[model samples]
Target: MPPVGRRERNKQEKLDRITAAAQELFAERGVDEVTTQEIADKADIGAGTLFLYAKSKGELLLLVQNSGYAEALVEGRSAAERIPDVLDAVLAIVRPVVECNRKQVDNGRTYLREIVFGDPAEPHHRDALALTVQTEEAIADVLRRDERFSADDAAALAHIVSAIMFLSMAATINRTNPINDVVQEIRDQVRALLRG
Candidate 1:
């Protein structure tokens, strides 16, 4: 019933355009093979304009990551309050992400492969580390809420959750075992880690 605000609409439209362009280029040539110019061309924008949305290819990659499945991961963490189990908070992000991987299966595995070998540290190496810490803090918030997991244990559990997710995602990409089977194993390992 209400008309969309111009400024809000413009911002989202810009982002959508950029991401669409990037996705096309990324999917065609793979993450590392694609260039900003290519993405801009695909988006029909000047190369400099890409900078307005993201700093470098890596930031663009993270931004794209953030815009897509990354939201599912972040949303669960964002829901966590200080009163809940931090492990559960961590699990929230992990669970949805794993679910996404199971659904995408192919694209998910490709993205995981690209992220691992890709140039995440292209401009600011710190960005990668920051992403790491961001997820860690999200997990911490979940664990800290419970008051049961010690600080050290909480942090450790968070790392375990992170590691398992990566491994499981990677294993899914490997296709040696089904995603569901790997997921159950990861869940079991995570449960054991948290209990200890």
Candidate 2:
């Protein structure tokens, strides 16, 4: 691979700082309470410079939360691979993601909102959407382990499972529920879907 240029390195450094600052501030206080200026100040960059990286606070939240979600998905996928029961395996894949999202409930909810409604043309928003697709594909892989499901069936069921997981996490009633309770809720729904 070619060596990275100084300008590319500097830009990545700035992006890293911005992501770290936003992650800390959002975890400490929900996204609504943290301003773009606060994130810029914490990152030690100009507000204009921050905007150049992320056009709005919503986009910044997308940038920060997407990383957490991606990591959770990876953890969940690894866990799912070891479990024998299909439903249990799916829940194994779900539990880590629920834990990650519920770490800060409001931020979790806001991140879902951004994924669903943010401009898809934006780079961060596109990355978030791609993560969702990756999550669905992971779930589908687990479903395919069962002999009863064909490829298409597994894909369809995985999409439904993804919806169930996301809705459970984003529901207003679940905003304050314990992560275990939310996971159980998803388990029940997924179990019924698989059994039926």
TM-score of each: 0.63, 0.98
lDDT by residue for model 1 over 1-196, one digit each (tens)? Answer: 7988999898778878888887666656656778899888878788887787777776666556544555665666666643254445556666666665555455556556645666655543344445556776677667766668778877877777777877787773446566567667776777787677
CA lDDT of each candidate?
0.67, 0.94
Q: Backbone collision count in every prediction?
A: 4, 0
RMSD of each: 5.5, 0.8
lDDT of 2 by residue, 109-185 (tens): 99999999999999999999999999999999999999999999999999999999999999999888999899999
Candidate that would win on lDDT: 2
lDDT of 1 at 99: 69
